[model samples]
Structures are given as C-alpha cells and as structure tokens.
Target: MSNNINRSLIGNILKSIRVEKNIPMKKIASALKVSESTVSQIETGKNSATKEKINEICHVCGCSFDYKTDRKKMIDLVLYIYTQYSNLSTDEMNSTIEEVKSNSFISCSYVRFEYYLILYMDGIINQNNEDVQLFKRILEIGKSSFSNKELSIYYDIKALEKMYLNDSIKA
Candidate 1:
C-alpha cells in the first residue's frame, strides 16, 4: 500500500495550504482526528488522504477544499456549465453570480463555480485550434503546480486571461 500512497497531488496541495496557513502539524492532526506522525507523513508526500478526511480538514481549517475534485470530473462539470454560462449575457452573469453569493451555501458552491468559470472562460476565446489545445495542456500543468504551491489570485486571473486569449504558451 505504500506504493499506492506515494506523492499524491492532493497530499502535496494539502501540505502547501497547511504551510501557508502557518498552522502546526499537531494542530491539523488534532483537528482531523489523526496523529501528528500521520500528518507529518502526509505533508512529506508519503501518503494521500481519503475524501472524507479532506472534507474534515477543510472544515477545521476554514480553507476551501479547492482540490477535492478530480481533473476529469472537474472538466466534465465545467463543460456542462459552460454551455449554460456561455449563453448568458455579461449583465446576467453578474446578477446571477451576485444572487448566488447571497445564499448560505455560497462559499461551498462558489468555489466550485469559480473553478469552472476559469475553464469556461478559457474555452471561449480560443484564437485557433492551437490555442484550445494549449489550454487543455495547461490544465494538467496547472494541477501539478498547485500540488505543492498556492496559486496567488493574481496568478490565477492572469493565467485565465492568457489561456482564453491565447497569450501564454502553456505556462
């Protein structure tokens, strides 16, 4: 099972987020009802987490569970929603987003929606076939980058623009 547990994207992302929050290993371990040794192993990328544990950790840390969805599921969800969101005018987009945020479940839903929006936007302004291909290429790259690093908001926004605009070359 050790081979099955090595260097997971989710484990690395969790480690990066935990470091960014400046929370101690023991604290996270306690919050997740696990041992410090387990947390340490996880942070070092020796193990991955179960989805249920990921949910509990997110609740305890007050951080969004940004990486809970697998790439295929994420892509499929975004593609389906893209069909709807693309049909809306800019004004409708703004209004719908605002109204959604007013709900109690906004935080959870918004995170997923926001993730989808970036991908949707990327698919919209495809300058050519090459541009579209690069966008998908970078989606995989983006996943790996986030595995051990926190993507800044500015970076995310810039990446979104470049992806949709075909301005960036798969970074």
Candidate 2:
C-alpha cells in the first residue's frame, strides 16, 4: 500500500469483519494462496496486501470491498446523527444507531469507539457501562492508529461527556 493509504485502518476493517464472521486467517490465506503469517501481517498492518488480495479476503469473509466510500459514509452518518439528535424522533435515532452497528464495513475499532462516544453523548448509553469502558480502552490502545478526524471526534465527545457529567453531579 502507498504511504497515503491508511494501512491500519483497512487492516482493522478486514480483521474486524473476519473475526466477527468467525473466518480464520488460514482460510483467507488459503483463498489468497498465501501463508497464514502473510494474512496476519496484512491484518496487523505490518505488511500490505494488493487490492486484489484485499478483495479476495473480503470475499472469503463474506463481505463486499467498498470500504473506502462506506467508511466515509458511516462517519458522516454518525456525525449527522449526533448533530441532529433533537430533530430525530426516538425511533429514528434508534434505527440510525442500529443501521450503523449492523454495517459490516464500519467495524473498525476507532469507528466503533466513535459510535459508542456518540451514543454516550446522546444518553442512549449510560456513562458507566462495559461498552463505554471497552471502547475507551480501544481508543487508548489504538490512539496512534486512528485518523485525525476520528481523534478529533473522540476528544470532542470526551470533553462534552465530562462537562455533562459535572453538571449532572452538581445538580
């Protein structure tokens, strides 16, 4: 992959889908006619796979390979849902959240962290919960792996969450 391409982001997406679908690295490696270690390297962003190899990995994992655009759309949707929280009805908001969660292409750890952050911001998820802790851990561990936009969202939401919690405690 070129230096311009976000290797870790792509790797995380593929790895997430693979693990979620219970598809083994060996299976993807076999499909790509490569060794399991090669698949591991690709998934960990230690090595890059060609576009054709990525597509074959996706095919083996039963997902489509339109992630570049899908990822952007998913981020846009999350931002829209956050900004338009009051304009949307309860059902609409719930439906939108479910849509994001169900999208196989949007399974990157940073994206998932952003999703959970939005949910916490909207009061859809409680502040004290396993989901929040899990995503927070993801953010901390993968801080270097995330994009600038994603990190911006994380810091913004975290500040907002802290302010809101403080106000609630004072009340």
Candidate 3:
C-alpha cells in the first residue's frame, strides 16, 4: 500500500502505548517472535500490517477496529472535536473533564481514553504536556469495557495506562 500515514502519529501512539505498558519494543517483538526490525517497521508504518500484523498490533495496543459499535466512532468524534477546537482553552478541556467526572459520560470513560489515544495515534493532538496526565487518570478509574467484557485486560491495561492518569476519562 502506497498510502501515506503520518509517522509521528504512529510513533507517538506506539511510544505511548509501549511506555504505558512499561515494556520495550524488543519485548513486544519477542512476544510476536519477530525481528525487532519487523515490529519497528509496522509501528513506523514503513510496512502495512497484514491480517496477522493487525491482530498483533491490536493485541499489543489494545485498540479495536470494530465496525459495529460506537466505541471507535465516538473516539474519532473526540479527536475531531480536538482538531476543530484545538483553540479550546484549557478551561474548556478542564470543564469537560469536570463534567466527565460528574457522571459516567463517554468522555470520562476508559473507552474515551482509548479514543483519545487513537486520536493521538492519528497525530490529531500533539506537542501537548497534558497527555501523560490524562493517560494516568484513565488508568486509575477507567473500567474494563473492552477487556472485562471481552476477557482481555492485556490491551486494556496497556491502553488505559495513560487514561488512568487522565481524570478527563469518563469511566
């Protein structure tokens, strides 16, 4: 595939996901029993993932590309909002965070954290210092919608690490 993908998006998402897991690329590559170069290639988008690679990436990153549900779609919306409202003041994000904390809204849930991260993966929001903090909040409070429901927390843990720190997460 000659489609151009933003490398920074892939790299930041991979880096954040990897960092959240407290593991290294070598470890992930080892899990796949593939060369580190191969894993690196996929993350860097030097190569596109085949079926196996997609599953592997999904396993490694805890992201779902489910076509039937709103989980992924809602997250995309959040990212879009971020892009359109990049001009949103810190007050706005903080207000949204407060609103999320009040109830189990989508924006405050672990799901939302995953969504935000997906945006991060797409390079929608970058060069910000608040990401790590938001990630941390989601990790602490966000429940396991994907994992507890699907019988997998490996991805949830990896994905929610950043969210736990992010009080901005809804659930």
Strongest candidate by lDDT: 2
Clashing pairs in 1: none
Clashing residue pairs, candidate 2? none
Measured over all alpha carbons after superposition, the RMSD of each candidate to the real structure, in angstroms, is 9.5, 5.7, 12.9
Better of 1 and 3 by lDDT: 1
- Superposed by TM-score, candidate 1 places the C-alpha of residue 25 at a distance from the truth, in angstroms, of 1.0
* Top candidate, metric TM-score: 2
Query: Which whole-number lDDT from 0 to 100 does residue 38 have in model 2?
Result: 88
Where does candidate 3 stray beyond 4 Å?
A: 6-12, 60-76, 79-114, 117-171
Candidate 1: tens digits of C-alpha lDDT, residues 40-114 = 776556766776776776666566564433444444444444444556555554454344335423223213333
Question: What are the TM-scores, per candidate, against the unseen true structure?
Answer: 0.39, 0.57, 0.41
Model 2, 71-169: lDDT tens per residue? 455567666665555464656767777676665354433354455445544442334443664555445544555457656766666765666567544
Residue 145, model 2, lDDT: 52
Ranking by TM-score: 2, 3, 1
Instruction: State which candidate, 2 or 3, has the greater lDDT.
Output: 2
Candidate 1: C-alpha lDDT = 0.49
Q: Candidates' lDDT values, in order?
A: 0.49, 0.61, 0.46
